[model samples]
Target: MRRLLLVSCSVAGLLALLPASGAVAVELPMRKAGLWEMKVLSGGSVPEMTMQQCTDATTDKDMSTAMAPMAKEICSKQDIQKTATGYVTDSVCGISGITVKSRAEITGDFNSAYTVKTSSQSEGGLAGAARDSNSTIEAKWVGACKADQKPGDIIMPGGMKMNVKDMEKMKALIPKK
Candidate 1:
């Protein structure tokens, strides 16, 4: 009687705690097609570039070409985490075992927006084994068209330039068929 009730109450209390322990939720930001700014922050040989510089250096056509190769390599890495919503990849790029993790949103737009966040370690071994050496990089970008845009329209805080070719290239790399 009393002992049976005590046992049942303990079991119910344990079951109630199970949901709280196993619950997990992740939220991602929303992005739409339009003009956007980019910023690249990196360590090592890769130069830190602004959104304007990337937009200027890449034309819609050129961007399409470069991004194809870049995305293929990035998506195929072993450390990549793929989910129904998006993907994340972590890798070691240099001989020094510098780790770089890039996270890109899986979206419907041909030229999907992305933000890559990278972290690195200086010591020549696995990330955990390494001593006190860590570095980080963040890259952000957006893509879209303007009606007033001509064949070679450039928009920016400065006089930076971007072409349809670059936009096209970026669009092709987005995760849509």
Candidate 2:
């Protein structure tokens, strides 16, 4: 009797573990457009210097030279998809010799058909200028799947390519207290 009981228990347990046949399957929601945003604050000012003056600065020249090469290397490392639309603005304030602030916004949809939008801004002091400079960049994306996708997944589409890694590096350039 004990042996018989053990066999019955084992069979019952195994049967219970099996899935029920003819069960209906549930489908997940389809991907959709989303919005994203990023903000960056750096050290510097652009108010005192015009576009030409800022471009002429040694620091600006160095940065321009460095970025040209860096862009190619970094862009390949960061594979991003989707269209991005944004702009850059610089302003100067106070007695600062040349303070500058720049902002860029991006928006696009991923392979999954999820939409993404983002904005980034940064401010800093121009090279060979007086006064301390401060800059800030803010980016925001909204839509479905945004909460699910990591920052790196959102690609800046079109010829204007960028990635979260680049943003992070740019953020690091900002001055901190």
Report the lDDT tens digits of candidate 1 across residue range 33-106. Answer: 35444444344444444433223323443443444344344233324344665444343222223323322323
Across residues 77-109, which tens digit of lDDT does each residue of candidate 2 receive?
211222234222211111123222212222222
Cα lDDT listed for each candidate: 0.35, 0.27
Q: Give candidate 1 misplaced runs (Cα > 4 Å).
A: 1-31, 41-66, 70-79, 83-86, 92-115, 121-144, 147-157, 164-177
- Candidate 2: list runs displaced more than 4 Å: 1-35, 39-127, 145-159, 165-177
TM values, all candidates: 0.33, 0.20
lDDT of 1: 0.35
Query: Number of the top candidate by lDDT?
Result: 1
Looking at model 1, report the run of 10 residues with the lowest lDDT sum: 13-22
